[model samples]
Target: MTGTTWDILLLGGASGIGKSRAAARLAAGTDGFIVEFDDVVSAVQAITTAEHHPALHHFDHAPDTARLTNDQVLALQIATAQALEPAVLGVVRNRLTVDTPALIEGDYLTPAAAARAVDDGQAAGRRVRAAFLHEDEPEQIAANYATREPDDGDQTERADVSARYSHWLAQQARTYALPVVPCRPWDTLPARIREAVD
Candidate 1:
């Protein structure tokens, strides 16, 4: 292990808020590895048949939650996020132990949790930054989701949930003093993200 802290950039935000693109740009510039929480959740779900597994109950698992209403699905999504904290933090710890820089991006990486990592002894002498992206209009966010290739459930419902999540994320960012960037049009998101991390 080196005596330097590893560079880990954490991007958190609502769905369809341009976090994916921002992460891609950062990774391209910094040669950083990307660790997405949704991918992590999917990987966990593939190997588990646990009925109580949080990810299994998420709205993304449409087949399983076919009978659930949008509100129920949203509740399950929140629960799954809370349940994944330990796993996400563990991944961060392992990644930071290595020399390579990493960019951990996803909706589940809350500002408070990132702040805990930011203040840890492991982050001393190294850069550990976090940013949250948000879109003011839920309709615009819904439109972004509607544009995705692989269609999921109702875009409007997802957007509504995303809007609520964004507000919550903003509060968390404020509480942790993390940067909250607007990604409405995503015209300058990558640049703004770079500035925030720097």
Candidate 2:
């Protein structure tokens, strides 16, 4: 496994866009693990509770509780990236050592980060592939939000943020040449990922 490894599959997308589901299926079918980026951030936030500050809203009319400033979000994102590094590296190393594969599920990896990972993986004798998920319609994503019922704290405003994130992700994927997988529904995503992985 240390010789040359398969691509490090990264599934990134808007919340509730089936990135996790696709990653789960990939992991189930291959030798991989699921690393949820949001979970990593939450864990860091809990540990650094002392440093945690109220997030400022982006919109002027946004609810007082709903605003999260760019600086605040960037801080959280950096912390999350730091926390995820060791974990991600561990997975990559383990897979390489044992000649296995890893399917990492997260949204924190910006296109630049993805490219960096690709370079690092290649240097370490492993390939890296990125997949960005996209939802065809906002209505479907809203329905998914209703079904998931994510926690009230970070994801309470998911319905609105998801659209923004999805659009941003799509643009990033196009700009970075990352593969974009359009997910129509939960049932269809696993098969698509399977095809990609296979």
What TM-scores do the predictions have?
A: 0.81, 0.68
Query: What lDDT tens digits, residue by residue, belong to model 1 across residues 177-196?
Result: 98888885477787777677
Model 1, runs deviating above 4 Å: 1-6, 51-71, 121-124, 150-154
- List per-prediction Cα lDDT, in the order shown: 0.73, 0.60
User: Total clashes, candidate 1?
Assistant: 0
**Which digits, one per residue and each the tens of the lDDT, describe model 2 over residues 131-184?**
778875667776777677655334434555565666766787779776677886
As for candidate 2, its clashing pairs are 56-67, 56-68, 57-67, 57-68
Which segments of model 2 are wrong by more than 4 Å? 1-7, 49-63, 67-100, 150-157, 194-198
How many steric clashes between backbone atoms does each model show?
A: 0, 4
Instruction: Give lDDT for model 2.
Output: 0.60
Q: What local lDDT does model 2 show for residue 55? A: 31
Cα deviation at 17, candidate 1, in Å, is: 1.5
